[model samples]
Target: MVFWVPILSYAAVILLTAVAVLRAPAPRPPHLAANALLRYLNLFPVGLMGLWGALGHIVFPARSAAAIGWATSPFQTEVGAANLGIGLAGVVAAFYPNWGFRAGVAVVTAGFLGGAAITHVVEIAETGNLAAGNAGPILYTDVLTPLLLLILLALTYRSARGPAA
Candidate 1:
């Protein structure tokens, strides 16, 4: 349940948007799809999931740590704070809709999630921790979300730029 929430939400938003766009018309604008993807991707997966992580770590630290196969520590609070920052930034990026600002948000989100994915891998290797939160969908999302965001960002930039000169 814990590991699935973000994945499900992320997939739900993307799938829904894709369906809507596909069903729209024959000559859909390319940039519209890219822009919508960027907005929802940031809003749901990055923003809401970050907030959810903050809630789990800050409000339910013991459970969060247990799920990750770790002892509760003050560091969880720091992690929660970082989640809060990322969440806020993601939410703002969705609303602001500027390429440069969205790029910065994507970079920061990638940094945080990419770092978390690396730490999760190290923890799994060092301690053989296979807890759901440590070695499940959470880890995959941590790694893949950033990559997807970058890809979408590139597509959006290209579409916005128009034809080659």
Candidate 2:
């Protein structure tokens, strides 16, 4: 049940936004709906991860520490703080119509996730930390989510620019 919550949260956000896109002004360009959807979707992971970390650190330190085989300490709090800051920055980027803002935040967030995936790979290789919590869905999502965001960004940029550009 706990496991399903995160997955459901993501799906809910996406599904709700899809509904909004579909119901948007019909006269707009075909890509407009998709672009708007992607713009909102870009913030999902950051917000989810941010709140997850912060809550884990503050209220559920035991479970959080167990997940990564770490002790409950101030480090978890620091991690929580960083996650919230990064996530909030993503929220700020969500408002801009300019690709520059979107791209900047997307790249940084993706880079963070990319780095996390690498760390997980290293932990698996070096320490054989096969704990489901350590090298499970999240590790892969770290890579896949960012890639999806990048693809969305590319599609949105190209859509905005047109083929002639």
Predicted structure with the largest lDDT when compared to the true one: 1
For candidate 2, write residues 1-165 as lDDT tens digits: 224434664686588678877778777676675566565655566655656656776678778777765567877777677667767766665565677777777788788779878987998999998665567766766777678768878878877677786
What are the TM-scores, per candidate, against the unseen true structure? 0.90, 0.78
Off by over 4 Å in 1: 23-26, 161-165
Model 2, global lDDT: 0.69
List where candidate 2 sits over 4 angstroms from the true fold.
Answer: 159-165
| Error at 36, model 2, angstroms | 3.3
Q: Distance from true position, residue 56, model 2, in Å?
A: 2.1
Report RMSD for candidate 2. Answer: 3.0
State the TM-score for model 1: 0.90
Q: State the lDDT of candidate 1 residue by residue for 24-133, as single tens digits.
A: 78788867777888888888889889899999999999999999899999999999999999989889988898888889999999999999999999999999999989
